[model samples]
Target: MVRIACLILALILPALVAADVADVYDFSDRAQEQRYRNLIAELRCPKCQNQNIADSNAPISKDMRDVVYRMMNDGASNEEIVESLVGRFGEFVRYKPEFDSRTFLLWATPAIAVFGGLLVVAGVVIRSRRSGSESPALSAEEKARVDKMLADQDRPS
Candidate 1:
């Protein structure tokens, strides 16, 4: 009986918690509503590390959601809201970082490394081909020994 009651509580607890957080804000326009949803999904939760603001249940996430709501209601452009949050929290608040001097290495490092690796592989292949095609001539004694071996093999052995 105790185990069954505990299981029921565990199952129902999340639904009750979710109901308390469903504070839906009405938008004056559908476009604004869409914009708000997009912005929340794009912004990262500073406290939650990898989670977006919309998916985090942390208190800081709630505060950020409220800020997004207020900013949208005030007719702020998407860029303005993003810039404001970025200014307050640094670039870490954005899921997709901009291609700037600070982040150039982050975006271009893999491509540069792959290109360098290809150049090394091509160099090695070219050297191997060149060496194989232009092999050193064998000494006359060595040639004679190889010929004798070939003759021996050819004889009905």
Candidate 2:
């Protein structure tokens, strides 16, 4: 009876402790709620680094969510909301950063890498083709000797 009580308590205690209470927000409509969701999903959590604000449980993420909600309530445009956050947190908060002078290299890196790979592949292909074409053909005497050796190998010891 004591063991059963201990087991039930142990299970219940962990479940209670592990369950996180989610933050609740009152939006005027479903569109506003969706916009809130999208904004949070697009914004990265500065404290969490790899996680978006929507997915992060960090204090900073909660604050950011609150700010987004307040801004939306005040009739701020999506661009205005994004700009405000970007101004406050720097461009690092945005999942898709604006293509500006600072971010040009970042956006161009994939293209540059692909072009470089193509050049390397072309060089290898050209080199292989050249080497293959330049190889001297075996002489008639050499072919005859190879055939003789093969015939000898086929014969019984």
Candidate 3:
């Protein structure tokens, strides 16, 4: 009976410990709640670089969500909330960073890479065409030797 009790407790203990407590915030209306949701979804978590604050379970994500809730209650606009977070955490916290001199290269990298690949492909094609067009002609002696080999193959012993 004690062993069975211990087994049950071991199974239930992990489930209790691994359970996440979701954040509960009271917004004035559905619109406010929705706006809060959108803002959190748009903001990337600093600790979990790939996940938005809304989807991340990191402690920093929870703090960020709290700040967003407080700011919304204070009647801050979405842009203002985003700018404040950006100011605090740098542009890395934004999933889609603003277009600027610093980010121009980031945005332009795909195009540059494609153009470079095309140039490499074009060079290969041009070189192949040039090399193929300049095939060396066989000398008279070589042609005669090839003809003799073909004639020998055609003759039965």
Candidate 4:
């Protein structure tokens, strides 16, 4: 039946696609495999900001995975692998960015904004307190008019 064929196709497609994964690289040891996993998890997929290379099915992510595997197999250090990728892809490749002069603003922006907001609020509060303590003096004519109005209001209806 067409329905049976469609269901079978749906089930088999994922396995066929998963067959294309970066598992082609053979690790000599469990530690090497774990390091490869960690590197892939830490690297972001260029096409998808929220997904790491390990979880992304994007072509770029697959390529990144391949590169990481190859680098690890060649006995490259983690920092060396990361730095090389960072050179090619920019610092956005890492989920946790390294701190440097260029990245200091990225890390500190939120705190700076909060501090600026608090300063603004303090200014407003200071203004309110200053304004509340005294009112502007009325002119003599206006004072006389207000006194007359009060006197009229106080009289028996």
* lDDT scores in order: 0.90, 0.94, 0.95, 0.90
Per-residue C-alpha lDDT of model 4 across residues 1-157, encoded as one tens digit per residue: 9999999999999999878634467788898889898999999888997899989989888888888888887889999999999999988898889888999999999999999999999999999999999899999999999999999999999
lDDT per residue for candidate 1 within 1-157, as digits (tens), equals: 9999999999999998877646489888898888888999999999887999999988888888899999888878889989999998889999889999999998999999999999999999999999889978999999999999999999995
Rank candidates by lDDT, best first: 3, 2, 1, 4
Best-to-worst order by TM-score is: 1, 3, 2, 4
Report the C-alpha lDDT of model 2 over 1-52, residue by residue, as the tens digit. 9999999999899999999989899988899899999999999998887899
> Stretches of candidate 2 above 4 Å error?
1-21, 135-157
Candidate 1 has which clashing residue pairs, if any? none
Indicate the worst ten consecutive residues by lDDT in candidate 1: 16-25
TM-score, one value per model: 0.81, 0.72, 0.73, 0.70
- Candidate achieving higher TM-score, 3 or 4: 3
Error of 4 at 52 (Å): 0.8
Instruction: Give the Å error, residue 150, model 2.
Output: 15
What is candidate 1's TM-score against the reference? 0.81
**Backbone Cα, N, C clashes tallied per candidate:** 0, 0, 0, 0
Reference-based TM-score, model 2: 0.72
